[model samples]
Target: MLAACRGFVFDLDGCVWQGEVLSPGAGEVLTALHRAGRRIAFLTNNSRATGPAIRAKLHRLGLAFAEHALTPLEIIGSVVAERFGRSRVLVIGAPELTAAVRAGGHDIVDVAAFRTATVVVVGNDFELTYERLAAAARAAAAGAPLVTPNVDPRLPIEGGDFLPGSGAIVAAVATAAGVRPVVVGKPESPLFRMALRRLGLEPAEAAMVGDSLESDVAGGRAVGMRTVLYAPGAPPAPGAADLVVRSFVELARAAGVG
Candidate 1:
């Protein structure tokens, strides 16, 4: 199935590895794909890291590819620039995400400026606080529309642990503001469109590979691409994915690679 596709998009955390540990055969599968001349785009909804940082992490994990990784930070930045045009944003996320937004030509205002900001952008913030949340909520309530990179509720950590992701923060603000956020990451069309555009392939010419049923599978299906789910120990739900593999070795084999 994968052999026919000219481009391949992969989700980072669960699809490639859980936390710091690389998934079994992940490096091999990627190397095989590269050797086969397939265009690769590594997509992550994780807002905690930037593209170069993610590339560094992937290098540490023994998977080296072209530095063409995509994150919601870049996607959100483009969206904000296009929609609002240099609007001031109250950002709630990692410093890296804040920098990305600023680099995209948007002004990053402090929480004190929340009410005056045109948008409230939320991402993964390890240092989330009630004060920040309150300010964001107030801003949203005061007509600042909420924008989130992704609404992933939990992020996988090492040793089978999980951490609250940006979605948690978004939910808090949304509940307080009584308005749902405009999501820009996976399961949303913007992220997928960005990936497809980078790959220069139409949806039917590429395959979306990941471990999440909701994000990867549903997003790929929605965009008219083939979907491969790489979850172990779980039964495949009806029409959840076009292909299901337990490990990267299986994924490679299914792709007609050794």
Candidate 2:
């Protein structure tokens, strides 16, 4: 089922790396696919870091194909610009996300201007506070559009650790504001479409590989792409993905690559 695809899309946090440590056999599988002339795109829902930062980290990790990487950070600007015209934006995310929104010809306003904010963009804010959350909630409650990356509750990290993801933050605002945010990342069509565009392949010609069955698998399936679940531990459910692999080695074998 996996051998027919000419291109592949991978998720970052779990499938490629668990944190600063790269997942075992990930580089080998990617190299084999590249050598076999398969187009690949790295689509991550991680909104904390920009694309360049991720590329630099990939370089440091000695992973090739850094050029094919995309994160919510890189595409957020365009997503915002196209969704909402230039207006006052309240950003409850990292500095990089703020910069992206500003670069989109939107004004980044603080909590003081929440009442007048045209839209509220939410991501993972490390320095989150009740004040910030309340302001963002108020802004959204006041009819400002709310946008976020993905709602993955947990982010996989090294040593089998996890962190609260952007979804956690988005959830807080959503509950308080009583509004479902406009999601631009996984489980949504925008990011998947962007990844396909980058690879220049139709959904039928490529596969989406990631750990999250809800986000990656569902998102890919929504776009009519085959799905591969990189589940290293627990047993996969019946028909969760088109294919399920315990490691990149297994994925390579299944895909009939090197």
Candidate 3:
């Protein structure tokens, strides 16, 4: 049931690898797809890494892909900058998130420098505290637009349990400030649209593959694209995907990629 598509989009981290442990045969699948001359892009909501960084990680894992073949924090940054401008933006995120914002020509402001903020961008911050949360809430309550990178609740780490993602932080800030943030990540966001545009493919001809039902499957399905759920240890939802597999290799097989 996986032999008719022109392009493929993959969600990183879970579907491809988890915390440096490459999913079994993941690289072989990607290698096969490349050999078959199929268009591939690694789509991710990991706002913690830039495209180059993600590319570096993939290279280290023995996967080969062009720099333009990945999208993550860069897209989110563009969205924020386009909507909120480059100056006076308060960010509650990690280095990559902040860097993405800055790369888009925006100024990053700390919570203490809140009075001048026109927007508040939130992502995964390991150093989060009540003070920062309160400051973000105040900024939002003061009429700053709230933008989130993605809503993944947890991220897999090498030897540790899943770490809380930006979603957890977004939930807390929204609850405290009584406002819902505009999320630019997956499952119901324009970020996928951005990817579609970048690939020059209509939504109907593109397919989204990921390991999660929330962002990858749900988000892709919501946008009318064929969706694949790669649940290595989890099962696909009853009716959430067009295809289900244990690895992206199955995705290539289905898409006639190799």
Candidate 4:
């Protein structure tokens, strides 16, 4: 099934690399695919990152294709601007996320003025504080719409360690605010459709390769694309993906690449 696909959508951070360390044989596989003229797209949920920064990292990492890359930041601003129009946003994320909201033409209100916020936006806040959390929650609780990039529970880092992801932080605010946020990233349709459109392929003609079963596999499956679960050093769940591989090398073999 994987060998027949025309396009391959890869998830960064985990599938292609774990933080600074590239996944074993990832570069070779991607290079081979690119040489074979396979359509490729890199989709990431890293809200703190920008498109140029991500592309720079990939170039340094030895993946040379100039494929279009998507980060939550690239789409976050547009999501807000299109849906809510110009409004005050109580942003609870990093500086990059704040810039996205600003670029979308939304005003970032101080948390102290949470009552005046027209929307509560959340994402990865590495320097999260109780105060920021409280203010965002208060804004959402008071009936401002809560919006978020993605709800990934944990993020993989260097040395095989993990950090609390955006979802982990969003959970706290959701519990306190008593509202479910409007999620814009994976496990959601917009990002998946955006990637598919970039590839110019119907869902069946493409495959989504990622480490997260929930975000990558389920999202791909929902859109009728084949899903490849990259379960390195662990047994993959049964029936979760159309194809399962232990590593990029294995995936390359299955896809008849490299």
List the candidates' TM-scores in order: 0.94, 0.96, 0.89, 0.96
Candidates, ranked, TM-score: 4, 2, 1, 3
Which scores higher on TM-score, 2 or 3? Answer: 2
Model 4 bad stretches (over 4 Å): none
The residue-by-residue lDDT of candidate 3 on 1-258, one tens digit each, is: 445656677888777778887777778887787677656677788867777788788888887664444555767767877776666788898877888778878888878988778889889998998888989999998889899888788887665458888899999988888888988778665767777777778777878888888889888888877888887766755676888886666666676764
**lDDT tens per residue, model 1, 1-258:** 777888889998877878989777888889898888888888999887777788888878877675678788776788888877888999988898888888888888898778789889988788889999999899889988888889998898777688987888889889999999988889987778888998899999999999888898899889999999988667677667889888888888877776
RMSD of 4: 1.2
Residues 1-258 of candidate 2 have per-residue lDDT tens digits of 888899999999988999998899998888888888889888899878877888888888887666778887777777878888777999998888898888878888988778989999999999899999999999999999999877889889998999999999999999999999998889888788988998899999999999999999999999999999999999688788988888899999988984
Q: Tell me, what's the RMSD of every candidate?
A: 1.5, 1.3, 2.3, 1.2
- Residue pairs with backbone overlap in model 4: none
**Reference-based TM-score, model 4:** 0.96
TM-score of candidate 3 to 2 decimals: 0.89
- For model 1, name the residue pairs that clash: none
lDDT of 1 at 107: 87
Kindly give the number of clashing pairs for every candidate. 0, 0, 4, 0
User: With candidate 4 superimposed using the best TM-score fit, by how many Å does residue 47's alpha carbon deviate from the native?
Assistant: 1.2
Report the C-alpha lDDT of model 4 over 1-258, residue by residue, as the tens digit: 888899999999788989987888888888899888899999998878887888889988887675678888878878887888888999999999999989998999997888999999999998888999999999999998899988999899987899999999999999999999888899887888988998999999999999998899999999999999999877766887888899888899889884
Residue 93 miss distance in model 4 (angstroms): 0.8
Count steric clashes of candidate 2: 0
